[model samples]
Target: MLEKVAWMNMLFDFYGVLLTERQKDFMDLYYCQNLSLGEIAGEFNVTRQAVYDTLKRAEQVLSQYEEKLGLVTKSTAERNKLATAAAMLEEYETVKSDGRVQQARKIIEEVLEM
Candidate 1:
């Protein structure tokens, strides 16, 4: 559940920048907080299906934004780069060579660029 919350937060943070306030609020309550459709409908004074439709539309919008912008892809790339850098750093710590240290530093810089 915590992992789901983290993923939803990342998605919302990336795409919510492109959404209206109401859309952001609806998504936060429905996805991040895991509110029921009926509960969200009651809060918004709408029918359950209306709430579901709003969520579906919001998801479509988020998918479109990710498809166009590649934010999530870029984020994943950067995370992988950082993980590689961390592994290099751990190896360097054990080996302790000037050349290996320099290579690890280069990897860290490349990860930072990503």
Candidate 2:
């Protein structure tokens, strides 16, 4: 359940602008704000079932966007690779004070910052 929430939030961060305004609002309320469907419905003056349907559709759309674009997946892989490279560089730096390793580490830091 927690992993689902985390994944949804990450997807929302990556592709939320593609969603309709209503979809964005409901997703934000339900996932980011941790609001219940009933509470969201009350705020929007709609039924709980409507809220549920909108959320489901939004989830589907987000998943589809991820399937096609793979931005989240690619970003995760790149980040993991960069982290691994950084760790290896750090370990090498401890054993040998190499200028090239320090330069490579600096470049990795810059990439990670982006």
Candidate 3:
């Protein structure tokens, strides 16, 4: 469940602008704010079923956007590559103490921060 929430958050971060304002609001409430369906429905003046359906639709839309664009996947892959490069640089630095390796590692860390 935690992983699914994290995945949804990642998808939302990548494709949330494509969603309607209501969709974004519900998503933020349910996922980021950790609100229950009943709670969200109460806040929105709607039924729990209505909130469920809207959330399901939003999830589907986000998943479809990811399927088409793969931005999240690409980003995860790039981060993984950067992490591997940083690790390799660290290992090399341990062996040689090269300032150039340290510089490259710092650059990779900056990119990962993005």
Instruction: Name the top TM-score candidate.
Output: 3
Arranged by TM-score with the best first, the candidates are: 3, 2, 1
Candidate 3 lDDT, tens digit per residue, 1-114?
999999999999999999999999999999999999999999999999999999999999999999999999999999999999999999999999889999999999999998
Error of 2 at 39 (Å): 1.4
The sequence of per-residue lDDT tens digits that candidate 2 reaches over residues 18-45 is 9999999999999999999999999999
Residue 80 lDDT (model 1): 81
TM-score of each: 0.76, 0.90, 0.98
Question: Where in model 1 is the C-alpha error above 4 Å?
Answer: 1-8, 97-114
- Scored by lDDT, the top model is 2
Best-to-worst order by lDDT is: 2, 3, 1
Model 1, 1-109: lDDT tens per residue?
7775676677788878778777787899988788988998899899999877777788788878888988977987888878787777767777775776777677776
| Colliding pairs, model 2 | none
Q: Give the per-residue Cα lDDT of candidate 2 at 71.
A: 100
